[model samples]
Target chain A: GAGVSQSPRYKVAKRGQDVALRCDPISGHVSLFWYQQALGQGPEFLTYFQNEAQLDKSGLPSDRFFAERPEGSVSTLKIQRTQQEDSAVYLCASSLALWERVYEQYFGPGTRLTVT
Target chain B: AQSVSQHNHHVILSEAASLELGCNYSYGGTVNLFWYVQYPGQHLQLLLKYFSGDPLVKGIKGFEAEFIKSKFSFNLRKPSVQWSDTAEYFCAVNAHYGGSQGNLIFGKGTKLSVKP
Candidate 1:
């Protein structure tokens, strides 16, 4: 794909249900990131991957939030026991590691997750 | 831990109006600064970035931001804003010295509404 791609552009889940959001980063890109943007707020850093390794999960809000990139490519962010506060748009981005500094991070259309 | 602040929550302007959005980061070491914009129903896109070399950097859509190290500020600007430029803007920073690397800390974001 020419840019990062996310599946299920929108999802409506009942409270306490588990949901998984998928992100397919650009081919050959070595870095992938996930962010959560609440209504009328900026995107908050959720996790980062420098390949298959989940190098940074420091930003994940709580145990209910989990992310993984098992093959250094496609990644999934799973939220367990979704609450009303969990409603937000989930974004995915990919970048080349060597071009990390000045290069712009490409973003996906974002999956808007609504927990009812 | 790295944190970012964007003082302005919302602003409204007409076409050709000048724009100035404030952004500040709290970190004691080298840092990378960035501004991202999210249009209505669109994905987040990078507006500009300050990695190194010059303290002042220009970005897309006639936007620019200057990094003031002493003040720990990276303010975004544009000489003229169009109605199409109405969007939410975010300021982000990553600790350059942190070994964890690549993950960014973002501000709450400012919503700019440009009236025709």
Candidate 2:
């Protein structure tokens, strides 16, 4: 079975530009999550979605960061006005069910974004 | 706020050597723990998890983790590591209550380099 996958393995953007990273979760996954991993750091939670509903956005660092998962499938994380601080790897993961079920999340290759 | 800590940032060991990476998380409530591994140029893969029942849980590739509630720790250990085991290991935790149910808090990660 295909695991979670992210598109545009690498991206380079100028400061103040907008960038969008996409993620395709497994076929029957009902939960999706986005995380940001800085250099030499572990991934930090960014947002979460259950099916098509956005349940938690508190982990998003700033208002410039937005995410959506419509139709309960693909998700996109859009960062507006990119900055040097935004240079990091954006990771996406999906699970078959909620954490209560103890379902392990499968991660994608992640999209490395560089803002110059 | 919840946070995870990985005791070692980097570790070097020869093939067939014993390996142990320490992880500790701070959270007051019941929690779920996970160990994820990321090989170079690959996505994060689940090594094991501790939800309940047995404290010692075995995962793929001869990896296992022991969840010590009293110490707030979940340490990963392998009796013999292979050259292919060289990768970044992450410890993550998620609370069972509040708005952070499905969101994971990750540690800074430990980089393991295996010499064959």
Candidate 3:
């Protein structure tokens, strides 16, 4: 089975520009998650979706970030007015279901966003 | 606030040597612990997870982690590491009952360099 896939492996955005990263979860995954990993640091939670219903977004840094999983399989994380601080790898993960099983997420090759 | 700590920023070891990476979290309640590894040019992959019952959890590639409630730690260990084990290791945790269920708190990753 194909693992999770992300578009635009690397993106260089100018400060103040808007950027959208896309993720394609596994065929039947019901839970999706987004995370941001800064250089030399761990990945921080961004948001999560359970079959098109966003369950959590508290990890989002600010209002500049928005995410959607309309169809429950594909997800997008959009950043408005990108800042140098927003430069990091955006990771997407998915699991078969929620609860303890959700911890066994399969990750995609992250999209590295570099804000200039 | 919940947080994860990885004691080592970088470690260099020769092939076949024993390995141990320390990880600790600051959450009092029941939680799910995990170890993730990211090889160069690859996405983050789940090493193992500790949810309930036995504290010792074995993962892919001969990796294991022990969850200690008293110590609030889930340290990863490998008896005999190979050169292929060189990578970045991340420890993560999420609340079990309340709080954020699907969102994980990750530690600053530990970079392991193995010499063949």
Candidate 4:
């Protein structure tokens, strides 16, 4: 689209429920990223994708959090068995490919998730 | 692990006053630094970046930042503050040695309140 777009601006899930957030990055963007922002905390890196290749997932807190950019355009962040501590905003960003080597990032509006 | 630190969690200033927000990062090798701003209920937008060359970088809205290599700091500063500048600011770093590649490590963020 125009800029990065995220789906379901807000989501409320009960404990142990599963939720999925979506992201549609700017067209032709080859590098995508996911980050989690807890209340009053900075956004923490969760994962990264370079043209459908999951280059990094070191920041995911647990196996419960999984992200994928199957076609390197649209991406989804799936959280299983959501916990109260998972309440926060999930942000997605994209760049004009990783090889470009520019640190410029375009961020989406972010999905606010609350685990009840 | 590479990480970013924001010295202040909240900062209050009057319009037209000078402002500065501190940011620091931990990295052992070459790194890319950036500053992003988010207005209330708005998406994040890039303010500035420091990839190489002169450490002093200028961004939109009369904002500037200095990257001090010795101190591992990239502090954002503006000579005059405006009420519109009241927002959340984040510092991020991308290091070739940090994660896989092009993954950003963000600071907790500083909330700036410019009272007119």
lDDT of each: 0.88, 0.93, 0.92, 0.90
Ten-residue region with minimum lDDT total, candidate 4 chain A = A96-105
Which stretches of candidate 3 lie above 4 Å from their native place?
A99-101
Q: What's the C-alpha lDDT at position A29 in model 4?
A: 84
Tens digit of lDDT per residue, candidate 4, span A7-116? Answer: 99999999999999999999998889999989888788899899899988988999999998888789999999999999999999999856646658899999999998
Name the Cα RMSD for model 1: 1.8
Docking class of 1: medium
Candidate 2 C-alpha lDDT tens digits along B27-101: 978889999999998889999998899999999999999999999999999999999999999999977775444
In order, what DockQ does each candidate have?
A: 0.54, 0.69, 0.67, 0.65
Error of 4 at B45 (Å): 1.1
Off by over 4 Å in 4: none
Highest DockQ, which number?
A: 2
- B1-116: candidate 3 lDDT, tens digit per residue: 88999999999999999999999999999888899999999999989999899999999999999999999999999999999999999999877656445578899999999999
**Could you list the iRMS of every candidate?**
2.7, 2.1, 2.2, 2.3
Runs with alpha carbons beyond 4 Å of true place in candidate 2: none
TM-score of chain A of each: 0.94, 0.97, 0.96, 0.96
Task: Considering only chain B, report the TM-score of model 4.
Answer: 0.96
Tens-place lDDT digits, model 1, residues B25-104? 89978788889888988888888888898999999878999999999999999999999998999998867663555676
Cα deviation of A23 in candidate 4 (Å)?
Answer: 0.4
Candidate 3 local Cα displacement, residue B47, angstroms = 0.8
